[model samples]
Target chain A: MFDDKFLPQFEQIAGYIHDGGAVAIQQILHAGRYGGIDLGYCVQPSVVPQTLPHFRQPREVSKEQIKAMITQHAEAAKRAIKAGFDGTEITSFMGYLLANFNSKFTNRRTDEYGGSVENRGRFMRELIYAIKEAQGDDHPLIVRLNGAELMDAHGGNTEDECFELMKMAGDAGVDMISVTVGWQEAPESSIGRDIPPGHWNRLAVRAKQLLPNIPIAFGVRLPNPVMANQNIADGEFDYWEVCRPLLAEPELLHKAAEDRLDEAKHCLGCMNCLSRLFRDLPYLCTNNPTLGHEVEPEYHITPAVVKKKVMIIGAGPSGIECAIAATKRGHDVTIYEKSNSIGGSLVGYAAYDMANKEDLRSQISYYKTMLDKLGIKVNLNTDVNPKLMRSILHQYDVAVVAAGAGVDTRGLPIPEQEGVLVTAADVAGGKVKVGQKVVVLGGGKIGLTLAEGLSQTGREVTVVEKEKRIAGDVIPTWKWRHTSWVEQLKIKTLTLSKPIKIGASGVTIVNEKGEETFLQADTVIAASPRRPNQELFQEFEFMVDELHGIGDALVPRGLLQAIHEGYRLGVRI
Target chain B: MVSTADEMFLDTEGWQAILDRRQEIFTDMLPGASLGILPKKNFDSPVGTMLTWVRQADRMEVAYQSFTGFENTSVDLLMVVDDETLEYLHSQAQDNAFNEMKEQIRNGNVLLYVMKTLDELLDLGYEELIEVLKIPVLGACR
Candidate 1:
């Protein structure tokens, strides 16, 4: 914005957007406290030291610099208009520079820019006025403000203060108000999957009520277009401001428009994308494997050079995903599962998941719909093995082992006992029953999830782990949730401990201190030490021309790797 | 007034002093603003050593409870420490203690916070505190 030399680049971008017949709004983002990524210091309204160590040290912006910043913003808006943009937007969301001025947590100015709510909001109001004036009335200007900063503990803006800022924006004659939620350093989750969809609709409703004349756009945690459309009909907000959901499935709107939403890949709200972005890596989605590979020729599904009969073992997320992708590429795909249903370990896990189970179940739903629409044959209750493959030896040109991993019963301390010991999978799959007192071995995500769910159901559950901490295998985003649920549900966790013996009455556990304690348990469940089902690789080595292993069958891992490996294998095959 | 983070948190007397000074703020807050502190001997291992402070009308009642892990305890806030942080506080190294505590807070071990206003504490619900306070109860995806 300081130089006109970048005008050609903006022009090219705007031209590309215009060619698509889409109205492009140039968002001049000044990531205030979060800026100066490569520099030693970031400029904030006040010198508030960073709560998150990832951010740079803050340097207070001078009054003179504040004036220059406003001028720069105005000039940026003008340059955007010159570049053929339909409108311009200024963002104060996510504790940015504008947010720094508005939030009491950062703004400590004693001059005209601080003290009262009106004074704190003066910067945003002025920026809105200046950008509107610079871009002219013909071009609309949108201001993105936080409906709730979720920073009250740190003396950040209250809900009323946030509403006051929105009101200020509306009174200043801004075209639209894009209400967002939470700051980067905020302790609570605003958009995570644990938060139910439509949880923040009340914020949107309040924003609309406060500013009836200004168009309000909001989509914080509200993912489904069907829900967004209903919210619009109910007057929750004027437009559904979506970004991450589109990142998960770029054709989300098109699928919604075509009424083929069941086929649309839903954003799981796993935060893998944001997690990567926070760590300075390229964005990747857990469910949508081709998210960052838009331009890669290998990622796109092209018609197979030679259509082959592809047999995928295990109708889990991995196998189902492969079946769908391969079928789309003109291959005759069929999925074989040992269970009565399609979803493998995921179905079991989702049943006990403390987080949004619907999001996990939605992936399975999408896969089922795609498989049906593509006419992919699914043979459930058919376990693929050497004997089974011999019957159909020449049936499939390629054999994909997506059979997934299972608990290593061999690693358990106690030998299996009827009605006394059950696998976590069996317990989750409802194939095996449990007693009143339950002892779960291995305190990773799987163990903790099972324990939490059982405890919720009034079963006295205890988790035993050899590690120093639980949730070691859980993703960083949901680690705290697991820990919290375990605490809230009063689930007992014995970290740095492992079960030594299992009996009819209970299990004996040994702690790190070389002391043994007896924890009475009616059932001891094994939930850890997952081993890949790689025996088929050796058995079917001479059976098929191509015997490839994917997902948990290759290595015991999580959903992201399983989906990615499946899709990648499907495209190449 | 205590001079440093170490001086303020090293002994029971220091904690009692803090509670006394901040009595008005604590008393004004809603009940159940109890804070739990778990100091681990090492970061990688679990150590059973715990401290709790419950807010009262006049002062905060500080006590040492049986070292139960966070799951069995109910508190508005909890602070868990790493080995180095505990060493710094024990050694009475003021600057080192403060800096290490800040780093630990970022690392999700120390859940240190300073509530500014009574309204802020009163208005925030239990779930909101779990979500918004940097208490490190760990749940957020994107």
Candidate 2:
């Protein structure tokens, strides 16, 4: 973006996109407070220090620098147009450099570039004018502004002020406005799965109301294409700015067009993409196995040369995913589940999930739909044990042990009574009954999710973890949410503590400090220290011509690992 | 090791080191503005052991004194950091240390309170104080 040297590359990209019959718009963003990673200093209208350690310290931008920046933006826009881009977009979203100039919290300059909303927006106005002049009238320019900064606590722009800025952009002759929500430093959740889809439609509605003449595009946390279409028809916004949804399913729009959205995989809103970006890693999607490895030939489904019959054990995310993939590759595939339903441990996990249960449930629905469409056979309530494998002895050429992880209760203190101890899976799946007082062993995501869910129902629940901190196994992005939910739900947590003995009335626990405590619990649930169901691999090894283990069967982990392993196995097999 | 005109005795080297490393925080303060750093141990109280700055006739003076109670002086903001976090800051390189400190602030391990309102500052949670006070706490991960 700094030089025209990359114009050849831009031309290639623009040509490639145009060759696909799509218009290309190059988005030029300057990470203001979030910039200067290598230089150790960012440029802003005022000397505002960074709020996050991930960003650099700020240096005040003089009037001369501001003028130079405006010209630089204009030149960049010209370069983009010359390279064959149909349009250009300059964003102030997520507290970028343009946002730093516009925000009252960041822009403390005493000069004309700071102060009142009008003066604060002058930089944007000048940039728009210059870029429009440089790119000419034929090319459109889209300005992305925050509809809600969600930074009210820090004295950031109010919703009213955000709209006022929108009006300024509209008046400045911008062709369209893409309204976004929240800053990276915003304390609350914006796009995470905890936030329900269509939660931010009000912002779009307000923007549409404020600027009737201007085209408004918004898709913050709104992943469903059908809902987006309805919102557009309802006049909430002129266009739907889809992003992460497409990341999960690149054929999202195409599926919607063919009325096959039910077949399209939905974004779980897990924030794994942003989470990876924060860690300076490549973007990875939880639901999309082929997201980052698109170019890898092994990651994609290809017609199998042998057309072998594949037998997949346990109809969870892993097994189902492998079934669908193998079926697509022209292999005869069938899934065997001991449970009455197709979704394995996920069925139980989704039931107790606090954040957007539909998101997790949709994964199962997607699997079910894809399995049916792919003509894969699924035998529910059929356990694939050694006996079953022996009976089916040469029936299937390949046996896949996707029989996902289970709670390892072997380490749990022996219960005085027969039914005092139960697996977290039993409790989550509603197979076991719980009493008023419950103590959950292990403070990982499963234990926490169950503890929080039980506490919400007015059950007295306490989580005892052997580790010093809970959520050691949870993803970095979601660790905060679990902690917050536990606090808000008033669920008691005992870290650095482990259950020593279990009784019918209560459980005996010991802390790290050698202090013993008796916690009254009607049921002690073992939720962690899960061992993979690797028994199938050994059991089916001699029986089947080819036997392999994928997902938690290989090693216990979460949905991401399960799907990735499943797809990789399916593709290669 | 080095002497200045207004050197004063402080309780811990941590407090002195904090002031020495982050003195620009004081220079950006208004003449009347005062901020108090409250250790996590003594968070129940309204006041903390003082590491403050006073603007004199021409020069800004850095003072490290004992807690004098909230009513005795006008304090604009209160920043609370756990004793462990302060020790953590001392154990790392200057740049790496502040980055961790800023991250601690972001995580609410370091808490900030606007003294006048007695309300927890939510601008940047704990780290926003750096922005509000114009203190260039530096370091980038890249």
Candidate 3:
């Protein structure tokens, strides 16, 4: 229905885009039961109640209405050919119009287009036949199908049924099968950080087995290019479909071809892109902030018109980002880190957790490789004091203070407390010793990570927090993962319990309900809040002509915020 | 236990040993089965922390269900360790919409367990826990 007005816009887009030798294909879909929810009405095979509250219930489609919709899809395909597209991909996945018609859960009608496998796939078959007829047999015609709806509980198609439907589409003369996973109504997380690399390639392999002649394209949470290549090599699928990974790193293929895999920015599988799409906003990447603004000239890092000497203090993510961006802009850059490693906090945090360590290490290795390639000067174990700041100001045109934050160790006041208190930073840095029975104060992200890390070592770990919840600052999509990990490790956490005193053998905790208890601990670690380290910035602000404070030195925040701040400063300077 | 000024901390080598131990434990537990841990609340309790570690290890198939909310039912097994979680499940069983769960429980297809405390749960060990829970119980479901 909306294709009538979008024809010219499609033509304009086709004319402007020129990716060398890459065939442009237009994808068309009818929201079907999922369509026009904002308008409060949609036409489907049957009236299926909306699972999510935000969506509106669709009106049942009569036979005549079905015939009209089929004609409309063919017309849309014709329009796409007119718009200079080489082919059109009809989407019958993710509870779209055709998918809803194909689903037994939604298609309860007893007419020619319902019930049995052949009947359930009748609408898709008709649509595909019409599209093939509209454009010649040689014209590229792809059909996107859910290899498995993953919605059996919702009365959706099983893997075998999906295979049958794909065969039906193949019989209907669809040139290619783009295999995807799950539906909108599927209860599980089909594609997220929780799903391992190359986990869903079996679905594609199954589709390939059924549709042997047709080329199969598959992608769902497959971010590792090496793993994707292996899957392709093993004949899982003919083509590796990628979208979000490109958003994370546009030069992914180019990097893979050049054997620069380490330099390639990999997708973290954080689901920020998916989240933005669900929110009806443009897709954005957490690792790469310049993703949605590819067309903007300012977002692209070009050679600086007037290059200057840039000195960055602290080799954390923020400082490293600034150094890289500045160096890319043809500026002389030097980074001074008090620690030996390039990744300040990440080195510690990543080293503590086994599951996410490799991904985090990959990110750090990429930055270190880039720094080496750019020939950026890096001085390790160099503390920047008042005298060092004075000397740095004299040498560089601009000085960026990214000294990072310090852990808060000023624990609770008690009369007879004599137990040792160590900061979370010390624990993460692998500096402080923790006994078999340990108690961590503060149930935030740092506290939880430390507690989990210690508990995994077969230590009796307990986390005490004044707040009611742990990892409260974690992203919504990743919160379940943290919660699940804590539960599995059996790390005891007492919430709404304040640390009263730290004694030689235990800590006295008082709950909000005025209940007092003593938790025995051989070691006590303070995972409290962090304060900004800005003393050097304050001292150097008046000494340097161009002085900037970024990252934790300016304000203690997460990695995304720090990188964004560093990037903003890099391009501006 | 030691004095505040005289306490000792593990150095980088000591921390690495801990990491190695964790990795060894995780690797030794495969090929793992899916285990669901349902908690009464959405807080940083022992259950939550354990679930987080299991997920992070990537060796085991684990699911966490918060008693306050129900999101998905894809897990192969369900663990209820607290009264609040069991009560929530009972309430869901009363609802007609949760007929699948009720049927699974009735037919001994769902692995249901109600433990007393975190220590009792951990003492069973990962292998023993899976062996005990994965076995289809007859009368425990009711």
Tell me which residue pairs clash in candidate 1: A32-A97, A188-B131, A271-B141, A480-B138, A481-B138, A487-B71, A506-A521
Better of 2 and 3 by lDDT: 2
The alpha-carbon lDDT assigned to residue A230 of candidate 3 equals: 89
Candidate 2 has what TM-score? 0.84
State the weakest 10-residue window (summed lDDT) of model 1 chain A.
A48-57
Clashes of 2: 1
Model 2 DockQ vs. reference: 0.05
User: TM-score for all predictions?
Assistant: 0.83, 0.84, 0.77
Complex DockQ, candidate 1: 0.09
Model 2 lDDT tens row, A228-333: 9999999999999999999999999989999998899989888888877865679899889999898989898999989999999989988988888888899999
**lDDT values for all models:** 0.80, 0.80, 0.70
Docking class of 2: incorrect
> Which runs of model 2 end up more than 4 angstroms from their true locations?
B1-142
lDDT tens readout by residue for model 1, A450-542: 898889889999999988778889887777778778867988889898777777788888999999999988888898878898889999999
